[model samples]
Target: MSNTVFCRKYQKELEALPFPPLPGKQGQEIQATVSKPAWEAWQALQTRLINEKHLNMLDPESRAYLMEQMQRFLDNQETDQAEGYVPPTQA
Candidate 1:
């Protein structure tokens, strides 16, 4: 079966898996594998989110809500990274 089909059929099994089954070599090796420009772009998005969208600016309840969403996004991004979901280069 195609990877898509296989993954779909076993969606639950795939739910929390690291796609490549191996984490990238950590530390410096990880940096070496990442393109400088791509890393810069990801850094920019991270900056925007924390500087403009973080909970510190919100009222307590709204801050809690935004914090929850942001935490989920961060958690998902971590999962995707572990699963080898490289983002496309910015145009």
Candidate 2:
């Protein structure tokens, strides 16, 4: 059976991630609170930010920035967005 979590982002019980996305306590916290859909959306936003902002993964500062953004996103707070990204139109 799929795991379920009280999603911090959606504020409702929803499908949970199968595993922690990272190591250590932070990862465990995410698994306990963040849902699968929220994490997937964060993945897309992170990819866009990396590309649009030309973030250097090797740089400690770049990693730190992404971590901050991830926290904000998961908590339903405003987050830094990629430049020139347009949301898709609904049909």
Q: Whose TM-score is greatest here?
A: 2
Estimate the TM-score for candidate 1. 0.31
With candidate 2 superimposed using the best TM-score fit, by how many Å does residue 7's alpha carbon deviate from the native? 0.3
Writing each residue's lDDT as its tens digit, candidate 1 over 25-87 gives 433332333333333444455455445544355478744654454334433343112233355
Report the Cα RMSD per candidate: 13.0, 1.4
Q: Candidates' TM-scores?
A: 0.31, 0.93
Compared with the true structure, all predictions reach lDDT values of: 0.38, 0.96
What's model 2's lDDT at 53?
A: 98
Error of 2 at 1 (Å): 3.2
Error of 2 at 11 (Å): 0.4
**Cα lDDT, model 2, residue 57:** 100
lDDT of 2 by residue, 1-91 (tens): 8879999999999999999999999999999999999999999999999999999999999999999999999999999999899889999
Winning candidate number (lDDT) = 2
Q: Candidate 2 regions off by >4 Å?
A: 88-91
